[model samples]
Target chain A: MLVIDNLKASINGKQILKGISLHVKEGEVHAIMGPNGSGKSTLAAILAGREFAAIDGGSVSYFGRNLLDMAPEERSRDGLFLGFQYPIEIPGVSMVNFMKTAINEHRKYRGLEPLSASDFLKLMREKKELVEIDSTLTNRSVNEGFSGGEKKKNEIFQMAMLEPRLAILDETDSGLDIDALRIVANGVNKLKRKDSSVIVITHYQRLLDFIVPDVVHVLYDGRIVKTAGKELALELEEKGYDWIKKEAEKTEESWRVNPQ
Target chain B: MNGNICQGGLFTLQESTVSENMENDSDKILDEVTSGDYKYGFYTDIEADQIAKGLNEDVVRMISQRKGEPGWLLEFRLRAYRHWLTMKMPGWANLKIPEIDYQDIIYYSAPRQKVAPGSLDEIDPELKKTFDRLGIPLDEQKHLSGVAVDAVMDSVSVATTFRETLAEMGIIFSSFSEAVKEYPDLVKRYLGSVVPYTDNYFAALNSAVFSDGSFCYIPKGVRCPMELSTYFRINAANTGQFERTLLVADEESYVSYLEGCTAPMRDENQLHAAVVEIVSERGAEVKYATVQNWYPGDKNGRGGIYNFVTKRGICKGDNSKISWTQVETGSAITWKYPSCILKGDNSVGEFYSVAVTNNHQQADTGTKMIHIGRNTRSTIVSKGISAGVSQNSYRGLVKVLKKASGARNFSQCDSLLLGDKCGAHTFPYIEVDNQTAVIEHEATTSKIGEDQIFYCNQRGISTEDAIGLIVNGYAREVINKLPMEFAVEAQKLLQISLEGSVG
Candidate 1:
């Protein structure tokens, strides 16, 4: 469903993702793990079509379309979703209104009529139940004055409402408590289907226990160094990222010496 | 007639067409320049009786004589004119007042009406069509929205509805000229009680040559049956509009009044100076709302209205309340402050305002609250939005006297800037002589961040709608105070004003 070939990206003349390659098929879950500043979130942002970073080389293809050529909103209409690391707080915009606008916009993109008010409200109630979001939270402003746990749960709620084909959850479990993590992971697990895929980006191996991944890749120094089964997450959790860093350094030295 | 073209159906059709085009290709939506022309820029063709260009004692006398004012009213006009001559135009406001050639502006201009219309059927068809084109449903049958309307064109009242029903409840609803003739005692007692003739430069000017405006009075213990509304339109060219409005709420009565204004587009800037006064007696509550949409000129700032208005109210008796709500999204230059004097013990005052300036428009508006009696309270919420190359400023004052023990005041002023070229400013003056008073003021300035836009765009919402949503949310605190129908119209006006303001 998605393909990235030798994708080289940079921000402010500094390379963030260099020659990164990845492939994910339908119904599969992939996890991209790395230490701080290792370009894990950068890869997620690039896939989301964020314009902050420039693509210096290579290409990305999604559903037989050039993903890089599309705008952010067009990418969204093409069934791509990016769960933000830090959810924005838009004061005065109620969560219900925001969701209605998003749902109607997606429907418009698909050449479908907007849902009626009653139908929309019923859908919201259904999704709220799936995500365990309180009714009062949906009536308030979008993410304003929300606790850390509520923010994460609201993101999951939005994901359920959008029902995107490919969702990239970037650090969704970073600031969540045990209960919130369970709820978020459970929501994502239930939303998964045979035709949809998810890319879970995180630093800790704790989240992998809840939503098991089919493939785990360790990213270091703007490149994917290794790809293996989900067991690699346990091994990396037992031993920190020191071994990976040393290995990457040796490869760098050898490349400098060999000029390749 | 063109009124059919300006109906609600046409607006809905246009909106659907835009969204339909947007669905096919969302990428080009951002690049598309979706600016809309002014909808109320058309002029009405009518024979007018206009005074020669000048501002002098003779012109003022001619206006008074034409209206057949009593001798005392003429003397009041002369006193204001004499006082205005001694006062040079005050330039303290944060406005760039162009060299206004007062000698070149016609003081009085009224559409020629041989006799006053006794009913809606007798009103001039041309004038009725003009109001219809402006989206003001003046016909009682077509609009049973429970809003009594007083439509004013140029310097005279053309039609007023629901007068008989209100009169049955001891409420006096009529034109200022008619009030001067029929209810002279009531008009004389409360005309300048709140905003005196020597209040300011614009107030003095309005008092001197002011022609016509709505006059409303709610008698003791009477709650107004419906919202009292007045629509002001400037149709004649080279004419300066000066309207005077007086509203009085007797003891234990309640009333809500709404005012809206628009002008025909012209190349040369027209002047509009107006004054509004309100008096609330013991246990009475008065709410005044204004949606000012005067012509704001073209994108390049070629022509618009210079709106200079003075509006103030007084809580004259114990436990009385007064509130002012305004949504201003028009005028090339706007300099107005609706104020309240809390002279009654335990009285309350509130001012909710949303001021939006786009393209080349400039607005400097706020409110003033004076706490003079014991245990008085006031709340002020002012939101200023600046888009395109315009500048919007909020200048307010809150004063508490020494004898006003236990007084309270809370003020929140926020500014949102859409583009990099526009500017927003807040200047709040606070004076507290009573140590027991609790006064709080909060101000914030925010720019529409790129991240916010991207976030919305990632949710399948286009940039234009995202900006509109963000702006409406920002001004929701103030817009929610307007009446239901006017709230929707104000939201649309906000959207239209900010269109094409972003890249």
Candidate 2:
């Protein structure tokens, strides 16, 4: 469903994602694990078309179309969803109104009629139940004064509302207690389908335990140096990232020698 | 006295341009706003009894003589004219007032009606059409829901509907001229009670040449059955509109009055100096609302209305209440501060305002709350929105006198800036002489967050509609205070005024 080849990206002249390559097929859940400053979030941001980072080299293809050429909103309309690590707080903009505009816009892009008021409200209720979002929270300004748990859950609620084909959860487990983490992971698990895919980017392997990934990739120094199955997450968690660091260093030395 | 002084310099921080492209974007947005047609710019083809372009004691007298006022009224105008000559134009506001050629402006320009219309049908069809185009229904049968309209064209009250119906309830609603002729006692008693002739530079000028406005009086113990509204239109060229509106709510009475103004597009800036005085007696309540949409000059700020208006209400009896709600979205240079004087014990005063300026429009508006009686309370909620190189300031004063024991006041002034070139300022002055008084003031300044815009854009709403929604939400506190029909109109006006103000 998504493919990235040798994605070289930088922000403000500092190369963040050096030479990264990844691919995900339909219905497969991929977990990208990395330590701090390993460019895990940068990959998610680049895929979502955030303009702050410059793509120096490489290509990201989504459903056989070049995703980098599209605007951020167009990417969203094209079924690319990024769950922000830190959700934006939009004061005076109710979540209900925000979701309505987003849903209608996406429908418009797909040549579908907008939802009626009753149907929209019904959809909101159904989605709220999926994520356990409070009805009052949906009426309030989007994430304004929301608790950390509420914000993460709201993101999932929005993901349910949009029903994107591919969803990238960036550090969704951060700032969430164990209960919230379980609820968020459960919500994502329910939204999974045979035609949809999920990319879970996290520094910790805790989130993967709830929404178990089929493939696990360790990103180090802007490159994915290790790929394995669900057992890799448990092995890395037990051994910590020190082993991964030494392996990444050896790979870097070999790449320098080979000049590939 | 020290607390009454607001300490701040206007335009202290120079805005830094982020990029040439951003500057160009702002200019393009402003161009879009200015390109929109001024829907109320059409003029009536009626001949006017226009006085020569000049202002002096003699000109003031001619206006009084034309109105055929009593000697006392003429003397009042002459006194105000003399006082105006001695005073210099006030430069305290954060505005650039291009030296107004007072002598070059025609002080009086009344449309020459062949005969005074006795009813709506007798009114000139062309004049009625002008109001119709402005969306002001003058025909009683087609009036806005329950709003009784007093349509003022040029410098005269053209048609006043539902007058007889209101008169039957002892609610005297008529033109200022008619009031002066028939109900002279009420007109003379409260003409300048709240805002006196010598209140300020503009008030003095308005007093000297004030041609026509609405006069409403709700009798004792009576509640006005319908909304009383006055629509002022400036249609003539080179004419300075000076309208004076007076409203009085007798003991135990209640009334809600609305004033709306608009002027046709003009190259040379036309002056609109108006004075509105309101009085609320014992146990009486008065709510005054204004939606001022004067012609704001084009992108380059070439032409528009120089709106200098003085509006105030006095709570003269115990338990009286007065509220001023204004939605100001136009005018090139607006200097207005509708205030309230809480003079009676336990009286209440409120000022809710939303001032929007775009495309070189400069507005320095707020309100004054003077607490003179014990337990008197006031609340001020002001929202200022500036876009496109415009400047919007909220300068307010809340004074608690020595004898105003237990007086309380709460004020919140927020500014929302749309672009880098625009500016927002707040200067709140608070004074308390009594130790028992409690006052709280909060102010905040915020720009339209880029993240907020992106969030909206990602959802499918266009940048323009997103800004409209955000701005309406910001001003909802003040706009919600408007009457039901006016609230919808105010929201639409805010959207139109801020169109293309954001990228």
Candidate 3:
């Protein structure tokens, strides 16, 4: 459902993703693993059409449509979702009102009628079960004083509400405990459909155990140096990226010798 | 050129005119009306019947005669005018007021084109259209829902709508001048009773030369059927719009009053000093709300209204309550403190204020609550927003007397700065002589954070929408306190007043 070709992105004039390319077909889960500062978050941010990220030279296409040209909200309406690494706290806007506005904005863009009050409340009740968000917190301001686990769970609850075609979980597992991680992973797993895809960006392989990926890629120094199947993540976790770095240097040397 | 106070007799325009011809002047008049920024410089071309320049007993007499007031009111005006001469300008407010030449200001100015309309259908179309441009129509039943309106043009109240309906409900809602003529006993009994002539400098000045304003009264055991509103407009140049509003709720009665004011742009600054007083008797409740959008002088502060107001209320009997809510967004220099007095046992006083100062405007406003009887209570919530090169401050006082046992007070003052050049300050004084009294105060200052805006944009909301959402949230507490019909309008007004605060 998506194709990212040689996508290179930078923020604040600092290159994050340097000519890294990837593709995930329909009904697939792709996990991109890396050490600190591996541009894993940058890839997710760029795909979600966030500001402050300029594409140096590359293209991102979703369902054969140019995704880079769409605004952040437009991308969401087009079924592109980004689970924030740190969710914002909007002090007077209740989560219920925020969700209603977001849903209506997307529906309006798609030339659909807004959900009735009863239907909206019904949908909210059904989504609450997926991530187990507290009803009291949902009635209060959006993430005004939510706990870390509650914030992460709220993100998954929102994901379920929007029901996007491609979901990018950026560091969603960082602040989650084992139980919370299981709950979030289970929520994401339940939302999977044959036409949808998931891109998980993490610094460790812990989250992958819950929802195993179909493909694994290692990003280092703004570029993906190696790609393999799910077993590669376990191997990298057992050994380290130092071996991958040395192998990448040798490959660069061979490329210079061949001059291709 | 000399630092001289034009002392002794009133500085008359006739004397200055002859002197201008006799002397070879080297210094020109400071014609800068815009306070360094001229936003609205377009003047409306309309003929006006203006009073002679300057303030004096003669000027007050002329205004009283122009309004055709009674001899009692004329004598009252003369007495107040004489008293104003002995008072000095107050320096407690953080405002740099210019020396006003009483004779140089035209006290009473009215449209010379038409006479007063006896009914709504007889009102001039041109004048009605003028009010329409200002977004308020004089016809009450047509524009306002479940409310009566009194439209004041220049310095006089032109017409009041829904009078008969109010009369049937035992409610008296009309202009102050009309009340002095019709309900002379009530006017005489209550006028200057809450805020007397010796209360303050501005109150004394307003009492002396105030031309017209609104007067409302709810009788015993009766509740007002609809909201009563008054709209004030200053269309004549050099004419200061001085208004006086009084609302009285009798035993077991309830009433709500709303007052709004706006003025057109003029090259010379106009003065708007008003006085408002309300009294709630035993078991009575009174609510007063104001949305002031007078012309705030230009950026450099050349033109705009000098709003010096004195507003107060008294809870005189047991179980009585009084509430004041104001949304002030305009004025060149504003100095006001709408206060309340809790005199009876179990009386309650509440004040909720939202003041915004933009461009070169300056506002120093807050409220005071004085507890006298036992078990009295008061609550105050103030929000100040400062943008451009403006300055806004909240200065308040909460005092509990020794006899005020078991008195309680809670006050919260918050300020929001929109730009680096602007400033916000809060000064709250609490004097509790009663050991049994309890008082709590909270103050906070915040600015529109760049990160907050970016976060909203990351969700695809525009910058303006984001700012609106944030401001609405900040003002939700006070907005929710307004009357249900007025809350929506007040919210929209907040958004428009804070426009361009966000980059």
Name the top DockQ candidate.
2
Q: In candidate 2, what are the lDDT values of residues B107-175, reduced to their tens digit? A: 888888788877789888888888888899788888777889999987889989998889899999988
In the range A80-132, model 1's lDDT, one tens digit per residue, is 99888877777788888888998999999999999999999999999999988
For model 3, the superposed segments whose C-alpha errors exceed 4 Å read A1-27, A36-39, A42-79, A107-132, A193-195, A220-225, A236-260, B1-47, B96-101, B112-115, B133-135, B266-268, B297-302, B500-503
Q: What is the TM-score of chain B alone in each candidate?
A: 0.92, 0.93, 0.89
- Answer with 1 or 3, whichever has the higher lDDT: 1
RMSD of each: 7.3, 5.0, 11.9
Error of 3 at B4 (Å): 50
DockQ of 2: 0.36
DockQ scores of all models, one per candidate: 0.29, 0.36, 0.11
lDDT of 3: 0.80
Q: How many residue pairs clash in all the candidates, one count each?
A: 0, 0, 23
Q: What is the lDDT of residue B24 in candidate 1?
A: 34
What is candidate 3's lDDT per residue for B1-503, written digit by digit as tens?
Answer: 00121221111212344234312211111111111232223345677778877887888888888878889888888888888889999987887788877677787887765766678878777777877776677776567688788888777787798998899988999998899888989998999999998898888889888988999999999989888899888887778888898889999999888888877776578888999999999999998898887888756767889999999999999999999999888888999999989998999999999998877889999999999989999999998877767899999999999999999999999887665667899999999999999999988887654334434544545455566676676677787787887788777666666564321
Which predicted model would earn the best lDDT?
A: 1
Candidates in descending TM-score order:
1, 2, 3
